[model samples]
Target: MIAPVENKPEDVPPAVVDEEEAEDGEDGAPETQGAGGEGKKKKKKKKPKKKKLEQTEPPSIGLSRLFSDGNYPEGEIQDYKDDNSYRTTSEEKRYDERRMMEDIDETYNNIRKAAEAHRHARKWARKFIRPGMRMLDIADGIEDAVRTTVEANGLEAGIAFPTGLSLNHCAAHYSPNPGDTLVLGEKDVLKIDIGVHVRGRICDSAFTLSFDPTYDPLLEAVRAATDTGVREAGIDVRLGELAGYIQETMESYEVEVNGKVLPVRPIEHLSGHTIHPYQIHGKKSVLLYKNEDQTKMEEGEYFAIETFGSTGRGKVVEQGEVSHYARRADAPHVPLRLTSAQNLLKSINKNFGTLPWCDGTSSGGGEQLNHLVSQGIVQDYPPLCDVRGAMTAQFEHTILLRPTRKEVVSRGDDY
Candidate 1:
């Protein structure tokens, strides 16, 4: 069972650890000291206790020892394999399942509509986005643009996934803090993740851009890796097979970001997840590694294919000390005060659909206040980070793994 999100008022964020520098042997084991002379004695140091929000440093081990030379290591890929699974069918049977005619037409129209909205919002981001803008400022602009574009197209503005704006080493879940007023630098690695839902169908996608011209190749590799994942989102594909494809292809590119070869290790804990109506990270997972759970790819299922690349190492550490309350899809229903709070928000969202709100200053504030006034059960406000250094890059696309084919909900000519 999933643990309830706890509310710890006194909790403090731990120091960030960079696992890229960890020392390991070629066999993926921590290296021991060389044999000493008969009279020599080996020394060991005590390990510090890990704090809840302690920051971890990069690993000391070289890529050669973790992964074989000329390739990236696969030490931590097992999580994906373990958490996800699929059925192995005969080759002939796998190829016979295709989308029905009605499904294909539905998918085509959804993709086209989603692509146009995405392009409009992306162009707005490209125009108002710059190095000097604060992260929230950019997010505000993108959100507004997305809502405006979708409404103009006669579409609903449902979020495909939570918008993420992680900067260097902070790969995901790095949004601006309340009252934060900071400026961006030329070296910042800006990763923008956004979504659009039209008429109950969703299209979620992401893009990563930077100020450094030299980092163009890194972006290109990320783009290619995302493409490869989407292209392989076909019926009956093995979970591990897709991950291996990404691992092998990106390693082959040897692109550098922030002075290090792109890390082969994805945020192993997080993989692309299923997207059904009103649900993100739904029941199905399109794992990047092999696993026992081969969730048979069914026709008409929508999925978000996301991938992250790093410069220091493939290993990702949680640098930000932020957390938010999310309702678990599989959790048992509870009779708690949260329902009232949820309803208040739900009503506002129902009306706004695709409209933008400034959280505190909007007329939506009336609706939000009514819930809070009732003393509804609200969890603690999660922490936020203001870290410097490190960079993050990502790409994503929403897709329908059709029975015999695949359709990209967020496909664009430029993609």
Candidate 2:
């Protein structure tokens, strides 16, 4: 259930939009002491852990596996406000079900406001972001900006998935390690992902911004693909149709840019997922692959249409970040600090969604979350699979599906 495209508002600059496409694994470093010169001479103490090696992932997983629904870890949710009487689903009792849905809609509206504010914060920060900056610093900026915006907007709390600062070739989890000499070079592609929660509902979103003027073609290609996908995302269109349309448009741009039929990677595993209130990457998925079930788009559903066109062969590999992948709610239960994770678990069936861990490298709550399905603790959705190369771009929009029309919940001036 992707949103329909509106007339590109004039206030919104003429631009491109598109698709693209997670994880965390980290080795802890020991503490270190600084050297000191006392009186005449004093030696410096030894440093702790060495910088982490650049992780190399395995060869590309076949296209078939990339698009498989099973590729993502899934969780279940079993808890909700019992006394509130806001979540009741009895097929036989239509009136009761309608009432429950109404409550959900009211609660979801609150969630949407929080999501919009969260996005506005990110957009505000984009003005200061540019080349020759530290990826870690940018991540920090996002953290600060998002936190400030969420609070000012009266939102309770939120979390950013892969609050990534991935540059060229680094599909995700590219935030530099401590002491690693990493800096954004000219013409680099940076992907930023963020999430927020309001009144227990969650919204997850991402944007890939480029600083290299030379890569404008790549950006434009992604934009065209994104526009094509968004334009085709309608109330009656099938889910696969968006993917198919994006694939077609991206291929055309691939040839025009490279002067050859360059194979644009259509990350099959990175298709958009459904969102319910505060929970993201929900049970249903809008697949890039052709699935009979996903062939029909329905009204009243929501979807994020993401597209990715890579410079390398259109193939991507997993890179063995299963540790970065989220665990299933049925997997096991563990304590976490991410407010979004907790709320998501409650809404998704505590057994349906897993808390995320960022390879445990960065300092943040719920760096990764685990759940026990049988115990009704949590479950994992298919986290994103990493792409193979450095040059990749993505675009996305959150939309509400109506019977005959759609509304972009995250519509902004830049679009």
When summed lDDT is taken over every stretch of 10 residues in candidate 2, the lowest stretch is: 18-27
What is the C-alpha lDDT profile of model 2 across 2-27, one tens digit per residue? 35466543444434321110011121
lDDT of 1 at 213: 73
Superposed model 1: Cα runs more than 4 Å off? 1-111, 152-156, 255-264, 290-293, 317-326, 337-389
Measured against the true structure, the TM-scores of the candidates, in listed sequence, are 0.62, 0.60
Q: lDDT per model, in order? A: 0.55, 0.52
The positional error of residue 180 in candidate 2, measured at the CA in angstroms, is: 5.2
Name the candidate that leads on lDDT: 1
Which candidate number has the best TM-score? 1
The CA root-mean-square deviation of candidate 1, after full C-alpha superposition on the true structure, stands at 25.6
lDDT (Cα, 0-100) at 370 in candidate 1: 44
